[model samples]
Target: MSHHSIEARDLAFSYPDGTVALDGVSFEITHGESVAIVGANGAGKSTLLMHLNGFLTPLRGSVRVGDVPVIKSTLSDIRKAIGTVFQDPDDQLFMPSVYEDVAFGPMNLGLPLEEVDARVIEALTQVDALRLKDRPPYRLSGGEKRAVAIATVLAMRPNALILDEPSSNLDPRARRRLIGLLGTFTHTKIIATHDLDLAMDLCERTIVMSGGTISADGRTGDIFTDDALLDSCGLERPLSMQNCPKCGRSD
Candidate 1:
């Protein structure tokens, strides 16, 4: 892969139970772009993210990260370029301590101990979780775990970051902090979420999916403002775009 740009071309997938997850979904995300995929439950947002990182392969189409295609033989290379942070922090953090969890990726790659230690410290510092290094991940609060989970991915030094429902189960302050943390990164980010407000805050481009296909792809502001489009796909205007109930003002 090169520059970490992502591309999905005419992709299609079906679950083992014969439920269709994606059908003819296609989009190209350029390097360093922040893109959001938003839709209702069962709209296939998570499935698509999984395909990008090779966690699930498309039955019919293909995905490319930069120039590298996501195939079984290149799975390692693909994963190395694309770091995925799943919807649940618990699914990610399992090591005894935050430091060990963050160091796991680099260690698995057989890097020198010095390199692994440096990477662990760097990743933790980036997520503002260095102070939590020696603590057990299971003992952390929701926000701390979220930060540490992100630190785990950052340690891999992936070119593009894929996150699913990253703001779920967080308090307002924690959500705000997550947003600020994500904004500081220069790498490409593709976020799948129900949180339109977070999408508006982080993504410049938004893709709307419905029935396992892309219904719309455009500017985040344009997509959020289109009430009919959102309604058709079971979405609502972001809170920032909606008029306030108290004073009838829109952000």
Candidate 2:
């Protein structure tokens, strides 16, 4: 079997208005690895995440999940293997109730009703949102909504998870909870975010995108330590913090 869980080769994308979003970007993520895609706004982080699950077909080159090429004919398979959480939970969690939103994926996957129910419960529990199952998604706090969105995708049991700004708009406590929750999942993960600290804490590797192309890819520590490259890509170095008795040091 191939070692790569997801692979992109010379990928390129353009908007309808003719703005290029990705240009010849390529990389491979192994199974169960956690990777962060970091860049400034409009650097194509969201566009790259969309390509992983076949939401957006490439204008040139290719993307593969497992060994399956992400094309029109294989879109369904690719999507089933990769779960995506958008930057805004409002965009992802549209069902009236939290339970319904979490159950949506499994239900669409054609699982038995009982199995779907079980999956939803398990997913919500994993994200610590089971208590909100009966609540309307619109009523949840920002962090709760984010957790619910993640639970919705988790219910489908995808092999890989693609998250856009997973910790955006969250308070410190909520952000820590989210980081801990994500750390428990074993699937391959590709996180697109501007939060350098979150990336440093959660990902082993980092890929820097600028002008729609991957300019740097390396160990998280190495990438974060390169001040010059980070500046060139319009990224800031992760904040240095003193060790705390409770949490060691800030990530």
Candidate 3:
């Protein structure tokens, strides 16, 4: 399989009420790279991710997954290529049982029963949620539901993974488990989050957003160390970086 890349060119969007969400945003994510989109609330991070998967059409400019533009004609293919996991597992885990939820995408792809079953099992195992296959989604704990939500997308075998606020509302153990799980995926990953520590751990590059524009984009360490930029973006250095005097971390 060829590597997957995403490109946005001069993207602009605004709400019907005339609130601009993105302003001439442009960037390219190389194949197999994990990048972080970080900003305070209302920085346009979620709006940009929605555009990537064709959930919302840009008012101007365009988004392309590989060579396919994210227009109506190519939306089906774009959705298949980009699997997005939203912050709330409840948004994705609608199927009754874990097994059914994980199987939904593969089943829709029209794979044979045997193939769909195999994909379901494999995806569930990847997230260490195989045992939850027989359980009801509503009965699961927050972390378990998150893992299953990821499995639902993984069974589709997408070329890229886009996550929003992935580590939100997790306990310490659950957070660490998620970090480990995300690390195992080889797909091109673009995570939009306010969790700086999670971004530092999972992504080599960080793109800082402010007021619907990309204010800074560079190595995670460099971006975090730019006190002026951080302040301008309404962010501070992560506690991990602050605690470690010699962190000198760069991706």
Reference-based lDDT, each prediction: 0.93, 0.90, 0.92
Backbone clashes per model, in order?
0, 0, 0
Model 1 lDDT, residue 63, Cα: 94
Point out where model 3 deviates above 4 Å: 243-251
**Candidate 2 per-residue C-alpha lDDT over 1-251 given as tens digits, one digit per residue, 9 for 90 to 100:** 24547889999999999999999999988899999999999999999988887889899999877778898899887787788999889999999999999988898899999999999999999999999999999999999999999999999988889899999899999999999999989889999988889888889999999999998999999988888999899987776522465777665
How well is each residue in 1-251 modelled by candidate 1, as lDDT tens digits?
45677999999999999999999999999999999999999999989998998889899999988888899999998888889998889999999999999999999889999999999999999999899999999999999999999999999999989999999999999999999999999989999999999999999999999999999999999999899999999999988889998999775
Task: For residues 1-251, write the lDDT of model 3, one tens digit per residue.
Answer: 25578999999999999999999999999999999999989999999999999998999999888877889988778888899998999999999899999999998889999999999999999999999999999999999999999999999999999999999999989999999999999999999988899999999999999988999989998998888899988998987777555765542
Which consecutive 10 residues in model 2 have the weakest lDDT in total?
238-247
Best-performing candidate as measured by TM-score: 1
Clash pairs for candidate 2: none
Q: Hey, what RMSD does candidate 3 come out at?
A: 2.8
State the lDDT at 31 in candidate 2: 92
Error of 1 at 152 (Å): 0.3
lDDT ranking, best first: 1, 3, 2
